[model samples]
Target: MKDPVLSHVRGTPNLLLGNYDLTALGYTVDEYFVAGTAVSYRPVGELGVDGHWDVVPAERADYLTRAVTVVPADGARFNGTVVVEWLNVSGGLDAPAVWLMAHRELLRAGYAYVGVSAQRVGIEGGAALVGDLSLKTLDPQRYAPLTHPGDAFAFDLFSQLGAVVRHRGDELLGDLRPERILAVGESQSAMFLTTYLNAVAPLAEIYDGYLVHSRFGPAAPLDGRSILDPDTVASLPCPRFRDDLRTPVLAVITETDLVGGVLPGYCTAGQPDEKFLRVWEIPGAAHADNYTIQGAFLDSGRAPIEDLAQAFRPTDTLMGRRLDRFLNFAPQHHYVLHAAIARLDDWVRTGRPAPAAARIALTDDESPTIATDSHGIARDGVRTPWVDTPLAATSGLNTESDRMSKLFGSGELFDTAHLHRRYPGGRTEYLTEFTTALDRTIAAGFLTSADRQEILELTAITAEWRFDPGAFHQSGSVR
Candidate 1:
């Protein structure tokens, strides 16, 4: 029961701190990695088949040292929540998706944050084929000592991190005394959490609540290599969850995740129960996009970086066909997630439950296509202002050939003449309706008042946005 050896890095950031600046968001950033030579874990019982109660089981295992990231909240504003993001090594680069999406809110609300480098690729370099995809390779001087035992030990490592933030293992968590330790994961990390919730939570209950965003399918591999490993097929499409749960799990899945990651029967799987679960199937959003990346730039007061997946155009070749509808998911997701984390805080503190959202209605056929209104926006689920405000009509569907579906989802804007035709009241009318909708949404508990001014300002900015004709269609046209 000895505490893991926790070390703070000072003077210079080894490969891990390579040009990744977080100061623009208002919080002073400090990076520390947790390491331990001996780690133990209780087994994550048998997998539950659909509708059958899973057999709760237990076993024991031991592993070596691993490093996890801890970012303390050191700023004027502290919201008293420590959001620990399971650092994503999916891109071979540490893609902090949820952090990027929710950082503005976390910083503004004064929440402490941490990134757990539980997987191999995060601490150890990707096995040869991926060349230098490790924090060590990125900065050997700083990251040289960092080590991760393997994927089998990741769940325990994450659990240890939760304890670190809650107990104030270091000054990185600040003096605010985090009231709730929230765990969230995006894309691949989400799947890992799904597994953790099912198998690990029963053994070690650490986090107050969980946000499984953009989770495409089932739980992570029990004893396999990390998905970021070059040889392993990391993703599995079977969407499953343990119905008999311990903590609240709020899952927000984008359109691209549905088509690409979650195949079929996820909705009807019967687990991920309503009592302990809240799943929001967003209509037109993608698995990944520039909104979060751009949000980082905006927060940092820096311009956009080189990743131009948003500007992707389909060519005659196989990679770029019928992808005209792909639009960078607007910033609505962050707002929604911000509100959700707030709800999570309330749910953990009080016994209050987070509001459940309507599931995105799927097609009758075997295929899982989202049904849409005449405006091409999703008809069901949480319809934020971006979906309600018809500047850009939406579709979550991606063509089968689109390998870039995770980074892009379907959004097609109306032509200039068509915009005027769709909204006769023009910008004035649009703003009024949007304000009304924002108010209603806030009342319904989907957004916070704190976000209104910023969203409204963004609306003003978008109103002046140069319409990209290449991605435009005539008004009343449905994709």
Candidate 2:
């Protein structure tokens, strides 16, 4: 494979929800356009239901795409790990969803982060996640030269970017030598990453590991069809990761992803964990929770406790419109994901495997629903203080009246009576129980100790918030 040419881009990068100051965190953010010919893939034989996709290079097209990279300002601070995020266009724009979720860990630990605009929706523009924002439309003069040959070629485009970062790190990272490269994507990008892991990773041999977060059952087809093409999507088959895997894959699933929302759920494709694969099903988590929509962009690792407190507040609005219920503000999804990233890095670099986790308990119904405990929190899966030491009921299912709000999930704090009954001793008793659960969660490897103080601090804030009558603004629910 030929190397792609990289030229520094001189303008404001139009990254959706990319609001953090990398410079303040001892990192520098830059944009570059990588130009080269990328090859699209086709199934070698029939596209089977099993994720063991056999594909070969089918068509070649010349393309130019942009990538935003955040690296340590002082090269000596580089931690030798580069996380390449397949920027999601589910919202009709390039969104660093995973980056938003795990930036605190990445920045604090000195890992470099890169967001690639690989999909057609990011470049050409279509649909609308948070308005019809795209590279071309955001800043015409700056991104005018960028071109993407549809999503059929997206797999190759992503692979090529990984190759550049792996083989030619100095070109992009200066003195930073990348020891391990992990490919991560969420939601729409996760679906595409699932296809990439099954098909392209075998041939390209680019990434050291893969993190497929919040993916639906069916992957984006190898052919040029996207999520927008319902006719083509309806005809495709759901796939499970091939049993014989070479690289390590950490699949993280939330309640909204396991069960159906607007699209098919991943429950159909669930498979047993192999030596190289680990599936973590999280209960009481949503596809896009409060941290995803609000906190991720603002929490830059500086004020960890203060920023995390923001996610605890309940709200019914999304983007702009008011929703039927409060958005799922459970912080477990974001905190657990931080640990997942750390575990993947260790697994790739030291040959250690991440501990296996229980799947979220579900009903036996054909269209399964997550089984919940008395508090309405999902049962089993990765246990956390939020669920075990509960003060409120949180769920990944919410109203489907609004298309975008469906993923935000729902939450309702326990009424004053229920709260009093659950913890008669009040704030002190709640903290004691919450702390015990937090310790156990960390020991079990679901939460990292590096984030322990922050978690405890956030919990303390939650205790104060819930105890304060002024903060309990919801009337009907408080009775």
Candidate 3:
């Protein structure tokens, strides 16, 4: 399959993403590139039924129009690699998974970031349908002209975007050339990439590599729901990754995903196949975490608390979030995600395959559950100081008052009674243990030297809570 022809492209002259000013957030309207193209790619494999792909000969061509918010080269702090981050349009909003956490790292490394709006929710929807959740509703003037064909055409649209960006990058990214472009998507988009890599990728051959973060199974249908067969919907949840990925692919799943049965029984962390596949089912991490909420807004230069307030259910007001404060349970998955990006770059650039990681241990039961250590921490996944440091008993699985926060997980620091029993030597011994855990994490390649300052800063935050538990306690509580 040849790359798509850039039939037409018109930039959004005065772009406004959400409520934030472009310049204040660093990237601006002048960097915007909107394109329409003729995409011809065959769906060779019969989604759930067939293994070997054969692009359906009859329906190979589709036209798509999409947007890419470009970060100009001169203004970019690029790290030689150009990252094409797929905007996660779940809940009908443009949520950038990587840019949320890796903003600081990306800026430091000088990597040019492009946020692609390739899905319908980011394009066609208006207030009548999706309300404030719709990009068009929030800012109709800026997003009025945007449109998407449907999910069926999304893969080809994404492929075309990458193809166009690689060959015609100057028009989009300016002087910053993409040394290597890794296609990245998270959760819902990750599921799409699973299909994209298995089906479209074998044909299009566009991206250098892929980072399919926080994925389970399920490939979207090749045609829209009005045309989708019922069996296709049932079978979507159980598709496999292609063995013949011409490029390296890294998949990072959290313990929350594992225990919750996001991946089917066959898709374990260590699958017996290609050297290009690396899956890290991390312990003490959540699907949508507290850090992600705060960091995501902070990185995008939005008001963190207020934005969260508007997005969450009305019952979950800003004051409730401010009051029910406890140390977060899960470690930020983005920390490891950033490292995987670096590792994947090395693998793509020099053919140095990353070391395969040990999978998280699960319990012996029909329903999947995590195997635990004496401290009740999940075992065998990416070992972070969060699980090893021993201040709070934190797990990726959470039970909260609401479904949304419940899925994100919870953290409970050891009460003074429990702390004294666990760490009799107090803060001194705890600090020593934390230092040891930090060393172990760094040695294991889970953490890089660049992360030292951030991790140390976190330890300080924990220390404050360690001595003054009241800082995060309920007003009526007696400690």
| Candidate 1 overall lDDT versus native | 0.62
Please report the candidate that would top TM-score against the real structure. Answer: 2
lDDT of each: 0.62, 0.86, 0.61
* Candidate 3 C-alpha lDDT tens digits along 1-479: 55444333455532223344445645543434354543434454354433344564233444444455546335545555778877776545666776665655565565666777766665665212113355566667765656665666677778778876788877666676777888888866776777678777877888988887877545555554411234654555455566666899988877655654333332332354367787877777766665565544444424543333222211212224532434244444767776777778878989988657888888877766778887677888787777877676666565455434544654566678877887788877777787888878777777766776656655655565565667534222322
Candidate 1 lDDT score at position 289: 55
Give the least accurate 10-residue stretch of model 1, judged by summed lDDT.
308-317
TM-score of model number 1: 0.82
Between candidates 1 and 3, the one scoring higher on lDDT is 1
Per-residue C-alpha lDDT of model 2 across residues 336-386, encoded as one tens digit per residue: 999999999989999999879999999999779999888788999999999
Model 3: how far is 296 from its true place, Å? 2.9
Clashes of each: 6, 1, 11
On a 0 to 100 scale, what is the lDDT of residue 301 in model 1? 25
Worst 10 residues of 3 by lDDT: 310-319
C-alpha RMSD for every candidate: 5.4, 2.1, 5.2
lDDT-superior candidate, 1 or 2: 2
Model 2 residue 329 CA deviation (Å) reads: 0.9
Off by over 4 Å in 3: 1-33, 38-52, 57-64, 70-77, 126-132, 225-233, 261-270, 299-328, 400-403, 470-479
